[model samples]
Target: MAFALQGRDQSLVALGCRKRYIRGPRRADALVGASGPAGSGRPHQSGTQQQRQQKQPLLAEQLWFDEERILVDESFEAAEGAQLSPHLKVAKHVGSGTSADVYKLQGDGKQPELVLKMAKPVPGLRRAFQREWMLGRRLNAVAAAASELNMIIHTGPAVVSEDKKGQLVFRGTVLEGINGKSLDSRLEKDASFCDVDFIMMMLQQVLTALHKAEALVGFQHGDLRISNIMEHSTDPEALQALRDDAQTWQAQGFVSAESAALAKGLLTFKILDFGHSKINERQARSYLKLSSPNMNTPADSAPAGSSSGSSSSSSSSSSLALQRLPAAKGPLEAFYSFWYRGRSDSWRLLRSLATRLDGR
Candidate 1:
């Protein structure tokens, strides 16, 4: 596929025949400056009122602007010693996002390197946890039946633990092992290492996973970038087999056949993270502007397809929905074929590989 730079022109089509767009109203606080009764500053007051006023502290302990204090309580370190369940031990901190903090956990002895993705105590993140947990379960079910989908990371069963008062606390989902280094890390280490053949293999596997996911789950991977792609170290024999296949494809004129260290078949790629994924619900709109990370603004939203612009509102006050273009079929298609606006991780990979190839 050719990599081209183009401006995005998407439609904001609702999923089903009757589209329902979720929009958040922009909160505009009006600061009105008022003087006591329009210049009647010194008004007489009752003795009881004056006495009560005098008793009140001039500087209230609680400030209205304490909203910004949300940052102080948003530390990922707070979950350092936290535990998911009696069996699941939340260990070292792995990563943090706006809605959740990822921790390396030790599950059953058989699965020592498990990951626990615990959502922060934010109401807005409820959907994120739900989406991920549901999607993970669906993928796992599919993988269990189909061996082709083995590439998709299978998340463990989701658990909803309670706090001290027996109230349902934040939601959490356990993922398989740490998987492998992200595609970004590998490229950062050696961008030049990705030749045409290697790119083809990676893309082939990723696209394969995407097609399966879409067909089986009826949803799209909202965020498909280098970082979201994981590269697993493979065996030497597998690497040789991949190299042989590439050579065959090259001879068939299907690929340019440029030679580069393929990391052997040693590098198998797996798609990671479903935080931005959207289900194919007929009642849902094609385009969504979530207030969570990777979904802050329309510019950062994932591609679904094209549709007519419309507007709707979300039940949560934090969410803001706008009338943008219709969603495309995931970011992968958008990346290779500039059918929409915004950055595509797949497109970036293609461009980077092209640049590296030209340099050589």
Candidate 2:
């Protein structure tokens, strides 16, 4: 599908543009006291107790592809009155995945509730967190003005720390906490309150945001499963009030005021987990080349009508279509081609969801 950013959304796109580089806070910066272990760092149960705990089913977020754990520096902020400093108070560990450890955070009175995602300190995993930080910084730059377009969680200022050897390390990232649950959580339980229209609207909102991201900076969110999609719990009454306030402002010819009012909590669906995202033209080209179907397979040179060739022909045709997309094509052509490639896992996920919804 050829998705273009709407003209009206141009300003919205610029609203989250991070044009400048953001430096992490150094040791000279105020330090939030090191976050202590959850409730006095008690030891775990032994033998059957531990085995029984392991036997229990994992939460949606905890179900990572692997369980190799790595210890990392968790003290990223300074201490303040009975709470962690830097405007974030660590609440508790929420979940863990191969990429990052997720934690719920209680923001100081001046800040909103947030989540902290600390990447494992393993060498191979460093680039993943760096990519996520880069993308988040880009999105966060515009969040102050384009609150509605702040679909992806807003990350607070980067907190830096040093290892024992004196090398600087990215302790973790603090992100805006959503008032609602992930789509997986909702889908696994009673979602009767959200009608089909609402669900579809949420889907549309997410796709629109993705399209905007592609148009502005050629970002492909590599992970788009149900767990990565968050539906905001913004109340209907609050939304309605915002609409009313916007209308009132509009009537007074205060166009900017109206937009500001409407932008408040206008976001419904947010696409998360850009840890695997491919950013910009170079990365996109590399991804396409890596993922293109039948790049040099035997079927590419096989004679017509054979079963192998016949089956591969369909896949190859799609690949050919992507190749044939003109180099001088419009801004969205690259995004379209990338999404249509056979290895586009997120596209497959969308298709699966559509099939399931259609069946229901």
Query: For candidate 1, lDDT tens digit of each residue in 93-209?
Result: 888888777888755563435677777777546545655654554555444333335566766644443333432322566666534578677557763443434455565556545
> How many backbone clashes can be found in candidate 1?
21
How much is the lDDT of residue 251 in candidate 2?
55
lDDT of 2 by residue, 142-221 (tens): 23222223566655544344355534344456666676677677656742322333343454556545654554446666
Task: Please report, as a residue range, the 10-residue window in candidate 2 with the lowest summed lDDT.
Answer: 27-36
Report clash pairs, candidate 2.
15-142, 16-142, 31-78, 32-77, 32-78, 32-79, 33-78, 33-79
Error of 2 at 62 (Å): 29
lDDT of each: 0.44, 0.43
lDDT of 2 at 239: 48
